[model samples]
Target: MGNARTFILMAVMTALLMGLGAMAGGSQGAILALMVAGAGNIWAWWNSDKMVLRQQGAVELSRANAPDLFDLTAALAQRAGLPMPRLYLLETDQPNAFATGRDPQNAAVAVTRGLVAAMSRDELAGVIAHELAHIRHRDTLMMTVTATMAGAIAMLGNMMMFTGGRDNRGGALGGILAMILAPLAAGLVQMAISRAREYEADRLAAEITGQPQALASALARIAQMAGRTVNIPAEKNPASAAMFIINPLHALRMDALFSTHPPTEERINRLMAMRA
Candidate 1:
């Protein structure tokens, strides 16, 4: 069901982009929009992991350097029937984690300093399992594409505004409307996709670790700590904020439109129900 929703949402985003283009510059504009979105997806697919890691100042960690983390990750990967993904450590006090890569073979997982210190062995296993679930289901790729399309749509809207949609049917009013609403629409679509996958990831993580309760506890703990502590890197790159296990942003005024993750309480409740 989640997969189906992701597919539908992605299709909607693409259609929205094409519609924006048509409004801004007729049939030619629609073609250009498609080209731009395609290029953006290609770039994001190959480099988003590196870009995100770099943005967060993440450092690669080997088994030799991070014995416990490496061992745990390896064990989890074995359970998931996936290759041992690369591990990274971020220098932050926020308790959060995220997975990246275009596919399972190229996948990587990163956890913050605070996450390592905050969780117990069992809780940590559940968290790792959650990230591994993302890799296994290829949610990472879906998210990357969604983000790229959303960004492209926003850029197209900006173009319309600046150019006054001189070639468009609706002219200045259309440009103004697109400028105001395109990003918001993109964000809504993107967030919808993100929210859909998160529930499935949570369920799969519970199955992988056989410890739904542990993950629930970890989620609650992470949420608590995240609210109190500042995640500097996430703050700097708010666009990447949706990648984390928890919403790490401090200001969440536009959560309805911008929140990438589902509600923590609801997520925890679902996991708890799974145990029952």
Candidate 2:
């Protein structure tokens, strides 16, 4: 059901982009929009990991220096029947983690310094399993694609902004609608996809680790700490905020339309309900 919903939402978002394009320039405009989105998605597919990590100043980890972290991730990846993903350490105080890469074979996982110090071994396993689930289901790639479309929509909206007052006909009204409504609609879809995938990742993580309560605990702890501990990199690069296990931005309000994560309390409750 989640996958179907995601597919439908993506189709709707694409149609929204093309509709806006047709409104602005006609059939040729719609074709132009698609080609642009395709190009962005393809470029992102190959470089999202590198770009995100570089933006966050992530340092690569290995068995030589971070044996415990590396080995735990390797064991979890093995249990999940995935290749051993490259590990990274984020130089931040927020207890958070995220997965990246086009697929499991090329994927990487990164954890904040606070996360390594805060979580118990079982909790850490739960977190690693959650990210592995994301890789397993290819959510990383799916999100990159969605984000590309969302960005394209926002870009169209911005272009309409500068051109809105140029005419007194329907062109002006179309520009008004595009400038205001199009970006709003794109943001809504991005939030929906991100929230749904997080739930699915949590559920799969629980199954893989056989430790729902541990994940629940980790979620609760992360939520508690996220507000007090600042993630400098995430604050500087707010777009990457959605990639983290929790909402890493300390200052942003958690609205459904804008927040990438569902309520942490709700997530914990769902995980606790899965206890057996």
Candidate 3:
């Protein structure tokens, strides 16, 4: 169901881009839009993981440096029948973790220092299992594709801002509107897709861990810390906010339209339901 929904949303986004193109130009314009969006998606597919890791200032860690963390993920990967993904550690004190890479074999999972210090063995396992579930399901790949479309939309909006409405029919007025509004709309769409995927990951995590309550508790803790603590890099690069276990943005009010994660309470409730 999550994969199906992903495809549907991607299709809708593609159609919207074409519509914007048509509005901006014509059939030729639509083709141009599709090409640009395609290229952006391809670029994101290969580079987004690296880009996000860099944004978080995560450092690749060896098993020697993080034996327990490595051992835990290795154990979980074996249980999940997945390749042992590379591990990374973030210096932040906000208890959070995220997964990246295009596929399970290529995946990397990063946990923050605070996370290791904060969660118990079971809770940490639950959290790591959740990220591995994302890897197993290829959520990173899907999100990269989604981000590409969103980035294309933002690029289109930028183009509109420059041409002074000369090339497109909207002329100066339409250009102004597209420039002002399209990126914001694209952001909302991206956020909606991200939120949906979070819910799906929560369900998948519960299945992987067989301990829904553990994940539920972890989510509560992460959410509480996310509010008070600042992930400086995430604040600098809001586009990568969806990559974290929590949104990681301290302000928390990036407009509902732009929110990438669902309300924490709802996510916890859904995870707890699996316990029942």
Candidate 4:
């Protein structure tokens, strides 16, 4: 069911991009955007693991350097029937973590310093397992593809705005409306698909960990601290926010409209239900 949902959502995102292309540019532009989006998927498929880890400023850690964490991930990967993905650590104080890679064989998992210091062993296992699930299920690939297309749609909207400015294509009021509405619509579509994938990932994580409560606790703690502290880098590059287990940006009411993750309370409730 989850797999089917993911396929459907991906198709929807692709169609949305095509429409945005047609609206902002034209039929030729639509073909161009599709080509761009396809090329991006190819790029992400080959290099996403390195790119995402680099974006987070994560550093490779070995058993000699970070023995416990390394061994923990190794053990969980073994249990999950996955390769031992590279482990990384971030310098941030926020308790957050994420996984990145095109597939299990190429995967890497990174946890913040704060996450290591803050979570109990069981809780940490749940978190790590969740990331492993993402790696195993190819969430990284899905997200990368989605980001590439959504970004193109948003960029097309920008191009339309500027073109309208110079050509007087839609006159003053009409141009203003296109400039404001187009990107907003595209962003909302991206957000909807992102949110759905997150829910499915959460459920998959619970199955991988076999202990939903731990992930639930970890999520609650992460959500509380995420709001109080600032992930300045994430704020500067909000497009990558969807990659994290928790949204890293500062609180904005509008973020709810475009949240990548489902509500924390609801996620926890679903986790708890798994025990029954």
Candidate 5:
């Protein structure tokens, strides 16, 4: 169901992009829009992981530098029947983690310094298992693609507004409407898809670790700390907020349209129910 929802939303977003293109420059514009979106998705698929890691200032952590973290992730990967993904450490006090890659074979998992300091061994396992679950389901790829498409739509809106709708019959009125609506619609779709996958990842992680309670506790603790601690990098790159296990931005109000992660209490309740 999550996969289906994501596919539908992505299709709708693409169609909207094409519609905007047609409005801006006619049939030829529509074709160009599709081509641009396709090319952007492909580029994001290959390089988004590296881009995200670089944006977050994540440093690769080796067995020599992080023996216990490496070994624990390896054990979790074994349990999940996945290859050992590369591990990274983010230098931040905010407790959070995320996984990124094009596929299982090339995946990477990153956690903050605060996460390592805050979570116990079991809680850490639960977090690692959750990230592994994302890799297992290929959520990382889907997420990156959605984000890229959404960003492209926003850029298209800006182009239409600045270009004065000169080439197509959309007119200044239509251009203004598209400029306001296109990115907003894309953001809603992106948030919906992110919420759906997050629930699925939570469920799969509980099953993988057989420790739903630990994850629940970890979620609770992370939520508490994240409220007070600042994640400067995430603040700087709010587009990447959905990738984190918890929402890292401090001031953004989390409503249906704005939130990437589901509510912490609800997520914890679901995990507790799984344990029960």
Candidate 6:
């Protein structure tokens, strides 16, 4: 059901792009914008893991340092039927984690120092399994495409203002519409894809580990602490904020408006329900 919703939402986004492009640029322009967006996302798909890791100041986790973490992650990956992705650690006080890479083969999971210190063995296991589910589901690629498309749609809306569109009247109208609607579309896109994917990951993680309560507990603790701590890298690169398990930049007012992830309280409620 989640996959179906995502597919329909993606189709809607593409159609919106084409329709908006036609109004502003012409049929050809819409196609070009989509092609460009696709190309850009393809590149992002290839290099996202490295770019994200570096942007967040993640370093490779050595087995020598966190042997238990390595073992737990390896076990979860096995259960998820995915390769043992490379592990990285971020030196932040915020209890958060994110998974990257286009597919299971190239994936990596980075956990913050705060997350390591905050969660217990079972809580950490639940968190790791959640990330492993993301890797297995190839959510990194799906989210990359959705985010890039949203930016492209927003950009196209702005483009109408400068280009006056191919037809002056049509361009004017398109520009007005894009300006009003582009951000709306972007918000919807993130909610439809990113938020749904998070729910799906939570469900799959529960299935993989058979311990929804642990993840629910981890989430509750993270939510309590995330607002208190500042994640500097997330603040700097706000667009990358959606990659984390929770909205790392929870304090940002704009995030409250656009909200990349689903509500933590609701997520916990669902997870807790699974235990009954």
Off by over 4 Å in 3: 1-3, 252-254
Candidate 6 error regions (>4 Å): 1-10, 161-164, 167-177, 251-257
lDDT of 3 by residue, 1-276 (tens): 557756776777787787678776778878988887777767877887888788789999888988888998899899888999989999888889999888887899999998999998888988898888888878887776776776677677667766644354677777778766776776667776778778887887788778999989998998887788887777787666777888787653546546778988999999888899
Model 1, 1-276: lDDT tens digits are 545755776678788898888887789889888777777777988998898899999999998999999999999999999999999999999999999888999999999999999999999999999999999998887776776777788788888877777455567777788987987887777786788788989999999999999999999999999999999998997777778999889975656446888989999999999999
lDDT of 5 by residue, 1-276 (tens): 546765786688889899878877888889999998879877987999999999999999999999999999999999999999999999999999999998999999999999999999999999999999999988888777777887888788888877756465566776678888998888777777788788888999999889999999999999999999999999998778888999888864535447878888999999999999
What's the TM for model 2?
0.89
Off by over 4 Å in 4: 1-11, 23-25, 165-168, 172-182
Give the distance in Å from residue 17's predicted Cα in candidate 4 to where it truly belongs.
3.9
Query: How do all models score by TM-score?
Result: 0.92, 0.89, 0.89, 0.88, 0.93, 0.86
lDDT of 6 at 31: 85
The lDDT-based order of candidates, best leading, equals 5, 1, 2, 6, 3, 4
Task: Tell me the tens digit of each residue's lDDT in model 4 across 176-233.
Answer: 5655665566567657766766766778778877888998999999999888877766
Residue 25 in candidate 2, Cα distance off native in Å? 2.2
lDDT-best of 2 and 6: 2
lDDT of prediction 3: 0.80
> Local error of candidate 3 at 209, Å?
2.3
Better of 3 and 6 by TM-score: 3
Residue pairs with colliding backbones in model 3 are: 165-171
User: What lDDT score is found at residue 254 in candidate 1?
Assistant: 57
Task: Indicate whether candidate 1 or candidate 5 has the larger lDDT.
Answer: 5
- What digit string (tens of lDDT, one per residue) describes model 6 on residues 92-190? 999999998888899999999999999999999898888888887878766656666676777777878766677675556657777668768667777
- Model 5: pairs clashing at backbone N, Cα or C within 3 Å: none
lDDT of 2 by residue, 1-276 (tens): 545654676677778888777766778878887777667767888998898889889999999999999999999999899999999999988899998888889899999899999999999999999999999888877666666677788788778766652342256666778878886787677787788889999999999899999999999998899889988888887667777899888654535447878989889989999995
